[model samples]
Target chain A: METDLGLWAVPIAMLGGAIRVSTPILFVSLGETLTERSGRINLGLEGTLVFGAMSGYALAVMTGSPWLGVIAAAITGALFGLVHGLICSLPKVNDIAIGIAMMLLGMGLAFYFGKPFIQPVAPDLPAIPLGWWSDLPQVRAALQVNVLFLIGLVAAGVLWWMLKATKIGLTLRVVGDSTDAARALGLTPSLVRTLATAAGGAFAGIGGAYLSLYYPGSWNEGISSGQGLMAVALVIFARWNPIACVGAAMLFGAAGALGPALQTIGVSSGYYLFYAAPYVLTLGVLIATSSPTQALSGAPGELSINK
Target chain B: MTLPKFSRRTFLSTSAALAAGAAFGPLPARAAGGMTVGFIYVGPKDDFGYNQAHAEGAAAVAAMDGVTIVEEENVAETTDVQKSMESMINFDGASLIFPTSFGYFDPHVLEVAPKYPDVRFEHAAGLWTEGMPSNIGSYFGYIGMGQYLNGITAGHMTASKKIGFVAAKPIPQVLLNINSFLLGARAVDPSITCQVIFTGEWSLAVKEAEATNALADAGCDVITCHVDGPKVVMETAAGRGCYICGYHADQSPLAPEKYLTGAEWNWAGVYPKMVQTMLDGGTIPNFLRGGLADGFVKMSPLGPAVTDAARTQFEATKAEIMKGGFQVIKGPLKDNKGNEIAGAGEGFAEDDIRLESMDYLVEGVIGATS
Candidate 1:
């Protein structure tokens, strides 16, 4: 079983790694996009993501079904989001401050409850084997994309359409663009933002499911290396567009995979620098796209950062 | 990844245990003179990895007479460990503390040791130079010898003649293991090559898994690792149908069929002896090091996948190690870059101080230290 494919292996491995790694970020960015689009920001998705990974892995182990674990993760994430949303909707409350608190609260709860789950082995989500026609093992290994990624792709498109043409999308936009405008149309801004934030949390939870039930496929205290927080920067870099978020996530994934992919081919120089590649890319993208003179394009008017 | 931190509930529970132990734990022979010892870990004690090995040692010390062991798991290596150490001394009446994590040695233990000169702090895998405080000591096992044994089994079982190592960092201890694994395999078959990948962190599960898959992809039939927790690497290798050798603790339970052999710390053998020496009014060494011959490290039971020839070689090698003066990094050795590490007839014995600062991979390894 000689797994080497010479120079060809690097790109193929990176391509596969990119798709696999990007799924969680894509799901998270999409969730963040949803929350931000409704005139709210849930920095607490970091907590939601970790909690989701814990609950998802725990359920999958107990039920022997990965899908149930994903459902459990989403439900838990939604509850976390609901709490965050409820607290932020009150008078004189800062969403950012509440979000940071919620992040700690969510992680603390997960660690406390996730203690017993550290050792249990959960069933992994199945891969689609998109490279079934390939004779090369590298191609086959690279093409073994998980089903969550496919859902994420559809999710990005569905979210794009749902935010563009639908009446629900119009209401969300109206609420996000201006609170006074939404009130003129008899829309409750807090209610809209709360539900939207919850939905966003559900998506972030699924991203966590992708982490513990698919790629890394285990529950531990260190399972997530701030991929949840990275999604915040990723969403901003994508200009708040769901479709763009997918591209940005893949780019970040490729950057993240650059170090290991190079190591596979015996390229070991600048190894530590590669660990900083994704963060570098994020900073580079943010710098190139933003101006000191104006707010970011497509940014929600009622979003706290914009204000 | 940031190591797990002790939660409020965990801290409270430890406080309760410390208070209870302080009040009631007394040996009849030394009831008035019993000493309280504290052990701190950077992760959960049952992680089935590095922390677990240390925790096992702490448990062994707990069973000894005239010693009250107070353990606080999930203490970060930050200034938080300083607080834990202070609490152990001030609140729990501990005079001897073992901060088991490697990172705890630096500023944390150094800062606190001088503050409490009467309290002895023994850190694992830290370099204790002459200028360091006398109360602060360091002890480490030469577990690379255990990895060498693992390589012997891997070399025999490997069908591809290419073994793989998934390493957490390119530090001295990890580099030593990587070199030793290759040297051990090369002793069995001269043609064997060990490909190495550094994940750059101690507990990045995603990178560890990817590195294992990448190694399996590169035709490595047997994989071993030097990571904080070998759980992800072992499971990933086993999942990919590659034979795996574990590190830090016994991981045969993770991949029973694919498990070959592993390098494990026999701290339970080392810790009790040190504590017993301290209890006997003897001074513990400031700088302590040992290997298989000294009962500081041991190997996991050879899995069913290992052959009789491998078993014979492994046992013979074990006996040779037990006899002492066994040199793994010896003559005719060139680093991967063709630079001479030792002259054609030169060799460094297992306990040589220079080996502790090893900074290069052996000739057969495929990765760079940097």
Candidate 2:
């Protein structure tokens, strides 16, 4: 019997928790990285993410296939992004303000439509059991990483490579660095930025899918919490790098898992305080790395936040 | 049906009427025609948890002949709830209102209850103290008794003798439940220990899921929680093949096979009785409280997995609670920190007011309050 795990369970639990917790954040932050790289930011990804979760869960429950639900979430997320992109591309529209409005709209719609699906059970995303050789059940459980997390890892690497070596990535960078420069080079900045933002929304939608179909795996109004909004800060902390987003997301995941992991071994006195670890880690990293005099390194020149 | 909307003109006129009523001593209680009762929830009504329990109550009340129930869901604990209360009073002409969420009591209910002295305000959980508005009343059930019952069932069902509790916050109410659960389990098997994890938010599904998995990973064969929405916790624990003991509402539908039993609020029985009292030209009690005997709380039917021994023990303990003066917290008790909770020859009874300010997990529970 593995009833008395003692202190050894904390690290193993935290490791499993990190992968589970970080997957959604990683997806959203990577999506935001793509959008921010093109000189536009979709703060509305929070709304899109939540909306995606609802749509994904509802679809998965209907289709009886988790993969179909993921696809449905991606499509809906892209549509939300398209709406954000189309509105932001208009003259005198503030993407930030529109993002807030879209967030409220998305949440409102989800709450209204999601009322029916709260009780129905949806099929969950599969996990790959990597701890086959381990005799300990804790080790086996910890190593059962979800497939979406593995996909997030590959997506991060691919996004990083595309941003550095692809022509499409170069067009995005050119449009993001200078609208006039891109226009002179016969590239339409608005069209490129809109597509990039939509693609980013697709990624965030996938993150939302991971949330409802895996880890906490249920359809409810409070499912996302502030994971969507947190990804915005995460993008900044990652310095707009997809690869860095994965690391930062895991840091947050580990912090989130810390309190619960300690409780397993009876270090639970101040367990509630541990939930704040992620936010504190984010604030600490932001202060330690940011300087008042310099523009943030690797920041998109035409990004609205920079302006 | 939609709750009556407050137009700008209606708001101004209602404000004037309220101001005038405040100065003119008190408006006469409206006892004519059908009465409007407003119910406000901090989350969606179908959340399958705390709000759902109250919503079920409201649904029962709605079926009454002369009662018109108006409900607004997803009302936050901020001034937004105050606005909802005022709207229910003004636009909907609600004579009595139930701001059911606990957070709505402190400033939201206290702030709004005084402004409308004629309308009755009932809050869930007995937070009403003297010098607060007389119009505002409090009512709650001793659901800890239900948790203790759940603990008895869990203790018998657990092969590993490790029960897990996923709670939200370390408040007195939650701590009391944790202590009672451990105590009940100890009654069955003295060596059984409860591992508790507080997720901090009432409805943070991700953390609740993580906590459940963590408990299951640590070899807890049975799991329960005090979170507002137990859907995620129940589903996750059942997914990992752990026996689930639900809270706030009946969750057997979520985990049919692995569910042991649950602690559920019987607001359906309590709410209508209170409404009927007011409807019959009677004053409702300001500090109404009860347990299984009074129908304030009820336990879910024992699951198919429950043993005959567990069922016998659960029914016996429940009868004791219903018989009244049943002391879950007794003499010679210590918290998880090895500090005394109840010294020898001293203990808090089932309805002890002192238990409301509980600040420690009892001995045999693996958790801390701070």
Q: Which structure among the candidates has the greatest TM-score?
A: 2
lDDT by residue for model 2 (B234-329), tens: 999998888999899999998799999999999999999999999899999898899889999999999999999999999888878878899999
lDDT (CA) for every model shown? Answer: 0.88, 0.89
In Å, residue B344's CA in model 1 sits off its true spot by: 2.9
Clashing pairs in 2: none
| Predicted complex 2: CAPRI docking category | medium
Put down candidate 2 lDDT per residue, A83-201, tens digits, no spaces. 98899999989989988998898888877888898888899999999999998888888888899999999999999999999999899899989999999999998899899989998
Can you give the DockQ of every candidate in the order shown? Answer: 0.53, 0.70
Distance from true position, residue A78, model 2, in Å?
0.3
Look at candidate 2 and tell me the lDDT of residue B362.
Answer: 88
Model 1 lDDT per residue over B93-118, tens place: 78899999888888889988987898
> Clashes in model 1: which pairs?
A3-B217
C-alpha RMSD over true interface residues, each candidate: 1.4, 1.4
Task: Give the least accurate 10-residue stretch of model 1 chain B, judged by summed lDDT.
Answer: B24-33
